[model samples]
Target: GAGVSQSPSNKVTEKGKDVELRCDPISGHTALYWYRQSLGQGLEFLIYFQGNSAPDKSGLPSDRFSAERTGGSVSTLTIQRTQQEDSAVYLCASSLSKPAYNEQFFGPGTRLTVL
Candidate 1:
């Protein structure tokens, strides 16, 4: 019974490098989410995947960001041509459903640093 998990807990790269963050949600969870947390700003919802289909992707900041979920389980967030402004903690969460009464389980997050 593993909870949500993310790989490469910390990543430091140059300004132009591309980074790929991975997330594995808990088994049987159908709702997955990607979020970004900056220094002082609160968590910003990036993309949401429900049962292998993304119903909401409006939160992606720009074209440099994209994500995909396969088999309604694992998800990967890719950032192309990273910038210093993109440095932040990328968090992934999952829940049984998208209902208002459901609670999301958060992962430890992958901290990306652009130097």
Candidate 2:
């Protein structure tokens, strides 16, 4: 599909383990975002990347969570020392411009389960 794509649609890991999730956005899209939705909770923004600017990582829950975008295209979210509380559906979205007007296409998401 021409839209966003995510890898390892599902993942399972034990507590204290580390994991990396990947996202590939539609070509030419300059803005990318990462979000996490825990069970029974609302969407939580984690990070945002726009063009060559430094990413806005204020939404990251903790130092254990991090993300990076390479060449303004592919992005990867890494979680270290995973805990059961870290389990959630991690979503990725991209748009041609910033939010508020442009529509952002989202990937199906990577389901993380920490047991």
Candidate 3:
């Protein structure tokens, strides 16, 4: 089965544009996580989704960032009014259990370049 998949692989946009990144988790996975890795830095948690539970959006950088999971599977992270600071590698991961164990599998990531 597929581990995780993200679209565009790379994106380039001007400041204030909106970008939507997609994530497809492995089948039967109950937990999904989104993260952003900036140049020369560690990954920054964006959000997490577990089953039908309310998503934990605490890690989102600002109101411009939002995400949604449908049918406990695929997810999307939408960045409204994208900024230069939002330029980073957006990674998605999933696990079989909630809270996402260390065994989670990650996507290749979508690299967003905002100029």
Candidate 4:
């Protein structure tokens, strides 16, 4: 009954701090995705989770970024040792199933600012 949603709509942090961004996907959806949009740039895929399989983390920028989905519902993206370049809008999306080309619903995103 709900669309994808992210928490802390806005986050301001120092260059070396760590931050945790949360996302809640639509109930019953089998596929979830995480993306980042930097200033003047297109959405960048960060990770993908589907059902009970291992997540696709190839899109993650570096070891500093990681995420986890619990019980196939809520997800959390953790950015360790944040950097100025990490400032951007973090978006989350969910679809009915894999082959994610299918229609997806996106969240309002969490705007992260590294000062």
lDDT of 2 by residue, 1-115 (tens): 4889998999999999999999999999999999999999999999999999999999999999999998779999999999999999999999987676889899999999999
Q: Name the lDDT of candidate 4.
A: 0.95
**What's the true lDDT of residue 47 in model 3?**
97
Q: Please write out the lDDT profile of model 4 over residues 42-103, one tens digit for every residue.
A: 99999999999999999999999999999999999999999999999999999988544678
Query: In model 2, which runs have C-alpha deviations exceeding 4 angstroms?
Result: none
Model 3, residue 107: C-alpha shift (Å) = 0.5
lDDT of each: 0.93, 0.94, 0.93, 0.95
Q: Which lDDT value does model 2 have at 65?
A: 96
All-Cα superposition RMSD per candidate? 1.0, 0.9, 1.1, 0.8
Sort by lDDT, best first: 4, 2, 3, 1
Give TM-scores for every candidate, taking all chains together and pairing residue i with residue i.
Answer: 0.96, 0.96, 0.96, 0.97
Angstrom error at residue 93, model 4: 0.2
Question: What does candidate 3 score on TM?
Answer: 0.96
Over the stretch 1-115, how does candidate 1's per-residue lDDT look in tens digits? 8999998899999999989999999999899999999999999999898885645899999999999898778999999999999999999999988646689999999999999
